[model samples]
Target: MPTTLRRSLLAVLATAFLGAAPSMAMAGVNPPTVDDNLDPGSSIHVTKTVSTPVIPPRPDVVLVVDSTGSMGPAIANVQSQLSTIVSSVKAAQADAQFAVADYKDVSDGASVFTVRSDLTGDPAAAQAAINAISAGGGGDGPEAQLNALWQIGAGGNRISFRPGSSRVVVWFGDASGHDPSLGHTLADAVTSLQGVSAKVVAINVAGGDGLNATGQATAVTSATGGQFFPSVAAGNLSQAILEGLTNLPVTVTAETACDPGLSVSFSLSLPRTVQSGSDLVLEETISVAPDARQGSTLTCTTRFKLNGADAGDEFVQRVAIGVNDVTPPTVACGPGVNPSGRTPGGWQQAGFFQMVADDNLAGVSVAIRDDATGTSFGPYAPGTYFKLTQAPGRSGSTAVPFTGAVDWHFGFRGDATLVATDAAGNTASATCSVPPAQK
Candidate 1:
């Protein structure tokens, strides 16, 4: 099979084993598992990639309806479908919350813009507030829409939105808002909405000079990071609300945390904003401290956020690091000295020489190998290893060539290598040469 097709099939099979469809975005760390025999004072890097979801979740929606005389049917429709809308949003995001508010003309009474309910997770409370709204008095062609928005958005968060949530105002009406409604102009409304991070989904109902009758809906929605749906039927308001929430624009960013022994740095100057569903690649350099003990493990996690809200564990990537020792022990062999004399059996007597081995972490053994004779000698421990013993008057001046060792004649005729091994299996060697009995 082709490489791409095979990978796709593997992904499908893996998702199937998990008993779920691939409906949500996921994040991953490249080379997820790191096992290395690294020397002390060394480091490595890991790549973490995070992708944003298609929808911004944890919506905090506020229904800002125009409760004018002509808006009875629209108000009633929303009240009836409030439960369904809540269920749909909760299905997409379990932490969704809702609120209710309405606006009428200032000329009618002192209750021009009233917040019926604060933002809450209780759908029943929001529905009760919407049900209590009686569309009765709205004088003239325009209502106090701008005033209502100002109160909800810039009026000190009159709706009490959750910090880190996607703020939305589902506003609908059949009439345009009064310019400078209750001392607040269109520009003031837009600025206030943006300040509170609120996105307006303006649904202009049909059968009258709508909210966009004078194009104010278009201006407000565009300037506040929202959408404008003109001439929508009063009955189809619920579906439009659902569509608005799903299609809402969101910003993505990344954050990282690591264990004490490990330090991490990223390639991107976070929190860098990215579009929804876009791939964000971050090169994370994970370094183990130079003084970190061998045979230890380090870990780090990279998490994602959507519009400043935590995107949960599904959008997190974790890395595990293993540290091992790779430094070899040091080995040195003393110079050769000629044999003192020959034995009666015509065998050369043993000469003295020393082999020293040192390791950074201790616990080392020393061994010797005769290159010319292909013979091996003792793998002696620290104190038991051979050492040079000078005869009387045979000081450093008369230290001639030697036939070394007792059993296998190491460095007997040619050169020999002294090897040292540490407890971690790291090895080092040094050569020792003996002249052939000085001719």
Candidate 2:
């Protein structure tokens, strides 16, 4: 984006980006991130990654807790912030499904170590469950955190993660958790979590457990490839948990490709970092050379950290450009006799032109060419040819006043060629030959 952007080579993207509006935002973005040294004769193939995982418009999240007596403040905080938190999460993931599973140490002996709520799309329902949870338990230092993880993380069927959904497990509490005693070790917890590929985001509420509690949470998350939050070691437990859930990581990629002679830019006006559920567009521009052939096709592709990342499924855009000038322009001529402005046929020499959007006709450009002698001339002068007024069919007519006769120079012939080209690389050409010999 901070490179020398050459504008002329990107004619193709002007139209293609407009056509692919659904897939991306029209922001300034560079597909290759850098574009100055690209080869002009080569096909363009640049990819730009978004770098942040788009928040799943609706993600499936399960809150597994270490609900013990000290958990009162943590659970209450969750209740107070539940609405705002869900609202914020829903802003990015409108269809976010939230469920809860509260667990105390198995040593707590039958006091509701594991309580599961079915996933619900309604934020209100999720908030209600969060508000209803109570922090009450008496046991050893460790809680049945892993067993709770086992039930849901192992796809225990009590909670179902939707298909094509991001799997997240958020757990918070004020104390440490035990690895064994529930008939399963820490490895068992890791294996269960692997079943669903759920990232276990652990929150050591209020720094109460000191190192041991955070250690257990860290071990589980590390085994599962989930991330551990900042080392601030303390904060509002509710804020910490929400931040872990909503501010997820991501990988983004954008690719802009084209045929030779066409320049493609993937990040014309695109953001380097995009948050989840943002309706932003990654703009791409493709320009073609003046001499590029007509009827050519072009493409743009973008891949993300997760496949199928485009909000509207607009991962790629392709189009065919039409070229003008398939045939030479037609030129009609009759030279005047003896250069006296008098034709033997009594008709003045002239040229006629037509093009698309006939009513919007602009005068055409023509230079004289002698086929036999290989010479070309003019940008003819005003009185040499006059444009027609209110012409028919987007047309223009002009008279060429020259020579006294059609064959003034005894068999000399002047073939006039007319060429017309349009904005989309379409060109038309025609040649009219003045007959040789006297007419």
Candidate 3:
């Protein structure tokens, strides 16, 4: 029998025996467990569905600008275009908030890095902060922008990012950042960005040895799952900020962890985009290895993420699988009754019958039922089965007595059913008939 066919049979048997089979009762995952019997070299597919929570477009944007003499043009651009940029972002994400921060060289003392404005919904305050930035003085080629990123990303609510809002840092600079700024390494800065779930859209101003020229911009953006715009003109700083806020892509991915004998696959390719406030459907196929041991259990757990961050409780699924056997045992019995035999009490006419049984998988047992007498005998399993028939014995007084074994013989039999069963409960049967004793 095929694995699937056997599973069907088991289901029918379960319903017949237990009133009703239990439902797949589980929370968060539909059909919590995959309880099926799968034979070797066979497979089954499963589907998993998860309802993505609705996430409205709420953006918490922070503008980190280079405040060095060389960045005069970029600062001027932000002052001139702040209102337009805010309007554009608001058009897409109505709940967008903005903040402003600036950084100069270490020698600039208190001006090395400054939070010009905390995150706010008021465009005027954001605009005022940008307009007040005076670009000047620096003692080194590299600036303290790296330090600024670390502070904003890991500075303990320094920028005050709103809850459940998309965190973005629009960083525009004309110089590469110092490797170790204020005792924090580049890696430390990147970790900070990830810690706060902040994406840095780095806009490299001017073509010369700037942020991109040293690969700092690329590293920061890539590490934070953000974007990097290279060789952007200082005048287009505002455009970069607008695009960074409005055009950023949101990707959906599932992190699946499964047991050894089982493997899982999805209907849709991973790392795909899922729009905000939209539902995401994931169809997964679960399969067991052909060589897996029968009756072994398989399992898998998957958690969905949105843009490199966990999508929370509503987006999790778990699966459990079971392997089963399908093939039934085979049995053969005598076509006619055996010779009559005498016991200590009397002559047993229809006593013994020849029988043999075998199973493809092992652990074969037998059951015999005398239809005429309505008497049933057992499920004679392995060790006990072979011990059913004992040596024939006779009474001393009776000469040449025809002795027969106990249990194996029947007092009277017309037709009997012989059933052979295997360890998996699969069975096969044959009938043996006893015609009226020799007449």
Who wins the lDDT comparison?
Answer: 1
Q: Which ten residues in a row have the lowest lDDT in candidate 1?
A: 390-399
* TM-scores of the candidates in the order shown: 0.72, 0.57, 0.50
Ranking by TM-score: 1, 2, 3
Poorly placed runs, candidate 2 (over 4 Å): 1-41, 45-57, 109-113, 155-157, 207-214, 229-235, 253-294, 300-439
Clashes of each: 4, 56, 1
Q: Which pairs, if any, clash in model 1?
A: 337-401, 337-402, 338-400, 338-401
Q: What is the C-alpha lDDT profile of model 3 across 230-342, one tens digit per residue?
A: 87898767666655553355666778898887777877768777533333455666777777666567777777665655545545666777766566777866322223322
Local distance difference test, candidate 2: 0.51
Candidate 3 has which clashing residue pairs, if any? 38-324
RMSD of 1: 8.6
Clashes of 3: 1
Model 2 Cα shift for residue 428 (angstroms):
13
Provide the lDDT at 432 for model 2: 47
Better-scoring candidate (lDDT), 2 or 3: 3
Candidate lDDT (C-alpha), each = 0.69, 0.51, 0.66
Candidate order by decreasing lDDT: 1, 3, 2
- Candidate 1: regions farther than 4 A off: 1-51, 258-298, 322-328, 334-355, 358-367, 375-384, 387-414, 421-427, 433-439
